[model samples]
Target: LGYANKTQLESLVRYDLSPVLTNPGLIPLLEKEAAKQKKRVKITLKCETGTHRQGLLLEEIPEYTTLLKKTSFLTLEGLSTHFANIEDTSDHSYARKQITLFKEFLHRFEKAGLPPQRNHIACSAATILFPDTHYQMVRTGISSYGYWSSKETYLSFRAHTSKELNLEPVLTWKTRIGQIKDVGPDAYIGYGCTYRTNQPTRLAILPVGYYDGFDRKLSNSGHVLIHGKRAPVRGRVCMNMIIVDITHIPGCRLNDEVILLGRSGDERLTADDMASLAGTINYEVLSRINPLIPRRIVP
Candidate 1:
């Protein structure tokens, strides 16, 4: 209700009623309105499949199922859960359990004659790995932007089937070199003097840093593409700048395009690559980008 505007509110009302009054805390207020209007209204209970970062637990499934069944005001429109790591075939225990619990949920609801029209359990990964679990429509996010469910998952799927649809990355992340300098051999670069060159070097400073969500942990370990070649990031990224060893790339100058998280000519830096360096994932790399940076949507 807080985030939903008039259009969304009306849309919710048109599709289902219980969602409007499922909270026991809101029951009294809803009842008062119903009393005043002399009508009865049904509601639907909405549950998070699981925390995005955390894997879904089978133990928690029954509690939510019971909650939905017990709510008098809520008319069950659907029962659903998420398979966070279904794409990762290396481990099947987690994905298998989630699927088992969802099947149990479907059985119980069907026996109760309240089987949900939408029994969604598959995300993009699940859709690719477990097609049979698609009881209803799939809820896709990353793939909608033309990215794979995950790198590991994509490889597995490709090995299994050659008839997959081609997907293209839709976003480009680029920035210009803010400054340039030539440093003598053994000169330290950036904060904490984390980088020391053995030979004379030319460095280009980029106006992006941890404060800009460039990730401080990437210092000295990450690479950015410039002039169609990979350049190592030097030292620690500061609030508004990063230093890169551009000595190998001749004719590099201030304001030249530096590919921090995108393709530059033939060289490319993917979100997954960045996340791997940061001990995270591709989702974190893209989502963690600060909102202050201007984003231009391309056709």
Candidate 2:
């Protein structure tokens, strides 16, 4: 629901897919597409309540609504906005303020007799933590995949709410050990010799690496689940390979299932765990997974 220019609008029109118009500049292009289709193209208008990134400003909403009325092809369907600081901090005051600003704009539009049929502002965090922000629909993103928007959101929800929110993780990243070897004391591993073995160490080479969305920053810091135990990463993570110390894992072998981000026995290496080690967010960890990787559903 993010159409910005004429080309995107044309494609959306050709496919008969409604998109959220983020800027007033696209209005003319939408009109042109509608004229060609000989029918009104239903579209939602995105208002910049506070984010100030995209969407019409408060003063521009009236003019945008007027433009919508002039064109026979443009039908106002919904109003939407985004939260800029909802998932970062423990305090949700800024997010609440955004909601307030959005509500004021919604009222202003209604007062102008151009009230949108559907109004949505809540993203994943708001949808789970603040139900009051749910107007007509909520845009559930990371949380839909069983990851919390942030640890703050989880804590805040638990502090205030009585309802239990059980989110089951949907994605599990798995790879197989390609090689197993033993390195003598003082042996360096991987490129640049970032890690040196202090003692005799058994290392398991995993096929998946930074190219497969494993963060390079996790080199020598991240842990993977091997035989229900934590196997520490060693040296630098290469484009297509990473070596982990598995000396403590009994009977480790080639082609053994490796848990990169999932449960193995009673141990789990979650997206959150990777995010913490990589100094990033869980969204990045999940979104950066290579699309070429096959996905299968399990019961």
Candidate 3:
């Protein structure tokens, strides 16, 4: 369930019992020991639901539901499923079908006379879109991280609710300028020399580049903030650096803080802006950040 695996759950259950079992054949040994002691062992199963990324198929779900019914486990605490797409309002037919199927399975479960204590089917998007689907608890992801599934959903929720929730962004980025140089009119900049100086230009080079998850496709199209003002990215974003025209901003220097993705003073470079330049989404922009870079959390 909810992106969990057998190995992980098994570890949690086996931790206490693992050490005391003398026989290497532990399952039999533990059962025999339990029989001697007149105690029983409990087992839990995690079933998959129909999620976009990972889950059982809708067609295959009934079989899983049937399996759950037949199995006589010591503890059967819950049944669950996930919605495929909750952000898309233009078409919710898929999500609606999934919800319907889950409801059908729950009805079957009840007919089997083995209703569970928990029956949940609502993630961040579904929870917002269909609160009635929340039988017990909602499993959230992106929304917990201060972003809605999409702009349409967020706007709709805000319009109806008439109140803003206190959600803060949890990530920031900054890098030092790698180098700085000046070029006269007609001078070419970067690979393919795609950009020629319209006028004499002073440029600052930043060490962050495509390899570091800055999109190479951005090229001359992206924007960066320098000296508290916006500067156009020049030429191609190289393997480990990008050049920006800083002639307009006075007092540009080496080792000045280069904000690849974050705010500086009143200027801000959002993940959405990065996505726009890269022809991607905000999720991709933030997740692509290389793990090798140090991350520090500030209150």
Candidate 4:
């Protein structure tokens, strides 16, 4: 609702894109736009279960519902809430309480005699961890990219259930080796001269760096796959380039495929691997990839 300007509100009315109502203040604006377009706008109320992010409180439901009742073109399509802690830990006590509160919110809507069609609360973690959270529909993400919500979520699932979800990575961040050069023994590589060769080394300069979300911390620590071989990153990661020691991978030339995060034969560089090196999470590594980078959908 924060980004819902006049143009966006009109777009909602013009298109059948169901939107979530986080704040009741935006209700009138949406209603006004819907009235102008003579369109039935589907709205899902995001209730404050426990996350305390963007959601309406229980006490505030009455006025919001009443206001919705006044808006003839506005239809309450769903009642949803986000889990506060479902993936980070093996414990789901807080998430259970959130589910309870969400149920109360659903009952509140039902008592008001305006039951929503789509009663959903499950995010990627919630959908994976708790089955009961799956009401009318499920919103599965990360898993769609063939990755687990988290290691904790995976452990919790394995501890409680026997089902094994065979999740193979579907994403592959690829770049071409922009340039390759040979460095004599003890020669420095890249900025700050962080890496010096012990012997003659062949380097593959990749067109990516921290600016490309190839984290700066990966300098001299991370490895990329080239010619199905592990090539160690050399020196400090630059704004738009990183030098990798590719001497071991023979017969590699300029524009050869470089795997920033993916597999090459038996070698794989995953977002999880990168995160471990960067002292962050896989989600951050995946999400921080520069949006301007062109993505190719492999069939």
Candidate 5:
């Protein structure tokens, strides 16, 4: 459920909260805390199945098991691992290999008389792509918010199954036009003169930029939805502002609502769209949005 060190483990034990022990080094610290508290502190052991980022390696599980047996107040509650390549591509072979290794370790723990009560290895992508990997519980993240893990994930699902995956976007980034300006032909817009108008242009200034997680790479590349039409971004994206060429949309006024990543009439710009323009993934696009911004539910 969570990873903890010596200090964090002490707090978790005091609160009687079980967490995932990713390192074997923490075993002694956990034993000390459990003994001090005079209560068994249950924990899930996270084995590094393949993702070399964290967790104890498969070769170290037996050593960890031996350490667990030496403690009277430390109980092994579950086993878990994470897949590193499950979301990057359409190929599932690496993920399947991770699942196989996870299962082998789970069986090994059972043979050692440390049969974990729960075994989980699937994250959001694996949960959708490989049902067999869902041993006990699956961690649903971006997909829970109605966004596909990646384009490859969507394609893989459609190619393998006939079931409909209806996901509605839950987040809509809305901002109003801060200012409107009319420029004559040959006028260069924004910093560094990155965008120069050949024809007279009507520019709508949006009060959102890199500071709000609207990536700077979107300069002169991204588009915003306004009046049900695509308005091209002009010049460099400033720290707190961006200009869009809305010359085609007539009758535009200051304070008009702009759709940064959402639906506007018949047009829509999704996190995927912004990610593509920014040279990143949808996860970064959505997660990087400033948390200080207010959120409200809408019908």
Candidate 6:
């Protein structure tokens, strides 16, 4: 909402959605748009506590507070900030510093009689690690998908509480065996001759590849689930194709459902596993999936 243009801001107001305003420049624009629409626009002001990504600085907030108070249709309904060091580690000294700065900003707002009704700074990590950051609302990200924010966040949660917090992953990436073929011994597979068959081998050609968000780094080092069994990636991951060794997986055929990153019978291939094998994070593994692919929602 902070970077929203005139048209977007108008649309948000029309849709009855409050936008988060970060830039002071957007304040006047929103006022004009809301006045034109004759609609009351409740906007959340993003205060730059410590992230330094968006929001007004402490010096800038006083002036903006004056400007925001002058608007007839635009109301500062919420105040928000983001924690810079809330994730990725257990040390939270910097996050605490940011919260202290936020409290100072809140104090000023209260004195100015422009106190926002909502104050939010909790991302997924903050929601789990620090209960105090949950003022009015929480902006959860990775945890919504039933995935932990990070190993450290999970560890911190485990160390603090004996209660169980079960978060099952809801997303599953699936593909089908496009073709199956037998290869002679010493035959090279895929581009660059990266994988050579030492013995007579059976391979399953998959229609998905790095282009579809199946990471290219999974080449040779990664495995997939087929018939509830593991199939090792046979060669370099291509733009639109990947080959997996299905020699041991019996009763395999073309168009057999393959689990790229999901449960298959009693077995599962998680984004966390893919992240580790690809030398990346679970978020990247899930977000990197190509958007062109059709997504289906199931219970």
RMSD of each candidate relative to the true structure: 5.4, 1.6, 6.4, 1.6, 2.2, 1.6
**Rank order (by lDDT, best first):** 6, 5, 4, 2, 1, 3
Give the clashing residue pairs of candidate 4, or none.
Answer: none
Give the C-alpha lDDT of model 3: 0.67
Off by over 4 Å in 6: none
Which parts of model 2 have CA positions greater than 4 angstroms off? none
lDDT of each: 0.70, 0.86, 0.67, 0.87, 0.88, 0.88
Candidate 5 lDDT at 277 equals: 79
Tens digit of per-residue lDDT, candidate 3, span 1-299? 43333334344344422221111223343444444455444422223444545444435545544544443322345666656666756366777877787776666656666565666778777777677788877877667766666676676577667666655555667887779898999999999999999899998999888888888988999988876788889999998889999898888788888777666779887777888778887778777888888888787
Q: In candidate 1, list every pair of residues with a backbone clash.
A: 17-42, 17-43, 18-42, 18-43, 18-44, 19-43, 19-44
**lDDT tens string, model 1, 1-299?**
11222334344444444442223344344444444555544543333333243222344545445555544444556655656666656565778776776676666666656666665666777777667877766777677766787776788677768876677667778899889999998999988898899999999999898887888889999988888999999999898889999989998987888888778888888877888899987777888888989999876
Best by lDDT: 6
Clashing pairs in 5: none
Task: Show model 1 residue runs off by greater than 4 Å.
Answer: 1-75, 91-94
Give one digit per residue, the lDDT tens place, for model 2 in 1-299. 56457767767887877788876777887898879977678888888877877777788777887777778787777889999988777788888888888888888888877778888898888898788988888899988899889888888888888989987778888998999999899999999999999999999999988999999999999998888899999999999999999999999998999889888889877889889888999999999999998999888
Better of 3 and 6 by lDDT: 6
Return the top candidate by TM-score. 4
TM-score for candidate 2, residues paired by index = 0.94
TM-score of model 5 vs. true structure: 0.90
lDDT against true structure, model 2: 0.86
Q: Which lDDT value does model 6 have at 252?
A: 99
Task: Please give each candidate's TM-score.
Answer: 0.76, 0.94, 0.74, 0.95, 0.90, 0.94
The TM-score obtained by model 4 is 0.95
Model 5 C-alpha lDDT versus the unseen true structure: 0.88
Q: List the residue pairs that clash in candidate 6.
A: none
